[model samples]
Target: MKYLKNSTDTNYSMFLTNPEVICRKIGNGFFLLSSKKTWDKCPYVQQISETGAFYWNLLEKGIQRDEMLDCFLREYNIMREEASEDLDYYIDMLIEYHYLTKIE
Candidate 1:
């Protein structure tokens, strides 16, 4: 939790801010679709893993990185470093693809 504030300029402080993205669940996974205006810029539809879907659900509700870590700890028996690393990669992917916006 202490890292939450200290990590402001780091990836760990970012939160999802995109609202024009759409996600639909299909067979225990989910597919993300961006609005038509955004589609031309980022054309690929993203298919996410179950864990990624969980993260996406949290993002849709405007969750923060520490909250993601908390959820990971509660749901999985993983180390904090591992959870943080994975979350960073996942969030980076979403942000890179325009699926999730990073809040400053």
Candidate 2:
């Protein structure tokens, strides 16, 4: 909700990648963890799905939420409603985990 208003339009411009957050490709999935610079209780290594890693890369590149949706729609063959719901849930989870920060 903070980063995305809806699937069609959004108020946020981009997500801020935490300086302490590190990401890596492990086989087919991704490995995510916080760096020593961050004292927060981030996990040592949180594994994510390939789809999740795809979105993570988009976020890491500072893509706007709406633009992310566009990319998602093009990359996957799912319905827009389904894609929107999935994206919203993923973004919300990332926000909760402090993996990404929203900007307006």
Candidate 3:
């Protein structure tokens, strides 16, 4: 499975509007607000779960999956197999959606 790595702090910029994180059940989608740009134009906006948002934030800090998995294992107390499966699923989804670029 492919994954992201080595992301730098420079890669991400904060949303100026401090966008409200809202989940829309109708479309099963997430949206954000932008204070820095025009209504139709904004930064790279994407819909992701709260957990995914957490991991994405960590990725911006250059955290790797191994480290994330360690944290997840400790926090969730789940089996390694289960954790690996879930991580792989999320990574695959991110890559498929073009939100993540595979390094190698």
Candidate 4:
């Protein structure tokens, strides 16, 4: 049997927002499609950062705060406090944009 090298840690459950919006992958990021009916003057497409994309993908399968902290810790040599702050900001942005939802 095969196993995923990095399985999701379920201590804290967080998921993506409803799949009401359309999305398309481009390079290392994603393009979110907004409906004209929802926002008559808003842009039809929105762009996100690479870090945002990473968290977005993780939200797809639900992830824990520690899991995300570990990811940042591995990707950079930042201190724990810095990592926590960054993660918090990332989550806040996603929440503000209605891209992420807390399951727990």
Please name the candidate that would achieve the greatest lDDT relative to the true structure.
Answer: 2
Which candidate model has the greater lDDT, 1 or 2?
A: 2
- In candidate 2, position 83 carries an lDDT of 75
lDDT of each: 0.68, 0.71, 0.50, 0.58
lDDT of 3 by residue, 1-104 (tens): 22333223223322111232222323655533234333344334566665665555554455667676776777676798877677767766655544455544
Between candidates 2 and 3, the lDDT winner:
2
Model 2: colliding residue pairs:
none
- Give one digit per residue, the lDDT tens place, for model 2 in 1-104: 12334343434344566767778897777888788666464566789877788788877776766778788888888888787788878877776777777665
* lDDT ranking of the models: 2, 1, 4, 3
Q: What is the lDDT of residue 62 in candidate 4?
A: 51
Q: In candidate 4, which residue ranges exceed 4 Å CA deviation?
A: 1-16, 21-30, 34-44
Give per-residue CA lDDT, model 4, range 1-104, as digits (tens).
Answer: 11111223435344545455455678867776667563443346778666656655655545556676677678777798876776777766655665554454
Pairs that collide in candidate 4 are none
Give TM-scores for every candidate, taking all chains together and pairing residue i with residue i. Answer: 0.76, 0.78, 0.52, 0.59
How far does residue 88 in candidate 2 sit from its true spot (Å)? Answer: 1.1
Q: Rank the candidates by TM-score, best first.
A: 2, 1, 4, 3
Displacement of the residue 19 alpha carbon in candidate 3, Å:
17
